[model samples]
Target: MPELIGIARLAAESPSLLGKKRVEYMSLTTRSYLTRCNNPRMPFRWMINPYRGCEFGCKYCYARYTHEFMELRDADAFEKKIFVKSFGPRRFLGELRKLPVGESIAIGTATDPYQPAEALYGVTRAMWEQFARTAGFRIGLVTKSNLVTRDAGVIASASRRHAVTIVVTITTLARDLAGALEPLAPRPELRLRAIRTLARAGIRVSVNLAPVLPLINDSEASLDAVAKAAAEAGAVSLGANVVYLKDCAKSIFFPFLEAQFPALAGRYQERFRNNAFLRGAYPEMIRERVGRIRRKYGLDSSREAAEPELWPRDPQLTLFS
Candidate 1:
């Protein structure tokens, strides 16, 4: 177990609250709700994660190491112990005002904001209500849950004045494979239904076929099926990225592969042994595959960032421009 300090230590000291199946919800104090991202590779500069640990428990989740910061060494603790950030709408709105206008904000960068806990605790929905008051902001939300559709009204209200995009992440349409990969997340078919609901509400929707596993869900037929579904559901764009095996993720994922997919386990070990990312030919092939799928479905890889007419002009934002 790594040494725990600061916020992680505080959260560890906090008493556990509700227990559900394998996961336990723990409440923690949050001084701030938004974080500024300095990663140049990412499109968004600001991000908000309503929860610290995700309940989805995906095999390839790269965020398991986040538990290490909390002194929870057991890799499984990342999924078994969930922490809900103490939400303050007033404080969150203040933090939002600090962001420079035109900068993008991504919700659920580290955890699914609309995860199962959301049904018991409506934090994600509350945040959207706060967003409804702001204008001239760019917001992006990604989720694997159909629960997002429950807040479609708030999302539509926010979109009236801001550039909002809701991305539904669907790895594969195969029920058994999806069941094994994202055990607790909503089914692929349910996510598609949510996409259609949001699109009909006039909210920009997209489908993300991310963490495209090599031997599992990366087949041409599989990718085409997801792309076609997104298009038929009225998605405006499509995007995908191959799997990345970070150190924390590999610790759990490697064993999972051995048990579930013995045939491909050895290949995965060799491919990820020397590198966290697959480079050279494999990535190039995936990019070409994704591009072809997008074109086939008439989906754009990029979205226009123009400000909507309803956005309230802000003189302070001009300073950052």
Candidate 2:
């Protein structure tokens, strides 16, 4: 028999958690719910992903590589085969308690914490439910779902205890285009509603106009529309990043373009064939463009430096910097 060592072993033996006709939810036993991000460039000190696969299935998702660790190589598997990590309340809190106070922890780094499964599994819900009891930590959550609005009260309470920021990613304001790009995510209008609701509840919220695809949605007008809506909806900050395509994402994205954006596929294939990050003028221009938009709306950068005294006991940290 072939050796199924480490994570692959656990992945193979995981029990079924839930089943949809087109999707399968598996229960993955986990030793630690929190992980340290050693990369110096990462803004947060720690990361947590409640679920392994995201059903939103955005055509340009860069997180596709995460599923490879489970030995699932097919691109579609990231969306179809979901893994819900087993959660033990006390244990989850225990691991959390061990971390020093005031350290930053980013949620949903690899996948959506509030993915559709979260409605059923409630792992993300449990996280905030427990976090409300804690004091003095920096928490940031990134998601593409408006389902987070359901826990607005709990999140607001937790915000009172610790520094909490919720970032709702809306790549475009055009509903049809958003549907085409992020097929399964909530509509752009719903996401904007979530932002307004969260902001009204006194929770700090931001907008991420990320993975700004070249020649697709990167136009000034396209980005400006998202920013204007985000600001009008009560977002205090906004951030945008150019698309970074790795082999894993390319395998899926390239084919998606051929089918949906055939005219642009060839250019994208050539541009990103060698490098993952599109550096130089295009990215710099985006930086300038996003900067202009941020100023125009009186908004802050999502990774803008935190006030040094937000947590006086520790050194200041930049979120997603």
| lDDT for model 1 | 0.88
Alpha carbon deviation, residue 245, candidate 1 (Å)? 0.5
For residues 46-101, write the lDDT of model 2, one tens digit per residue. 99999998999998999999999888889899999999999988887887777776
Clashing pairs for model 2 are: none
- C-alpha displacement of 129 in model 2, angstroms? 1.2
Candidate 2, residue 265: Cα displacement in angstroms equals 0.6
lDDT (Cα, 0-100) at 290 in candidate 2: 92
TM-score of each: 0.95, 0.94
Name the TM-score of candidate 1. Answer: 0.95
- lDDT, candidate 1, residue 120? 85
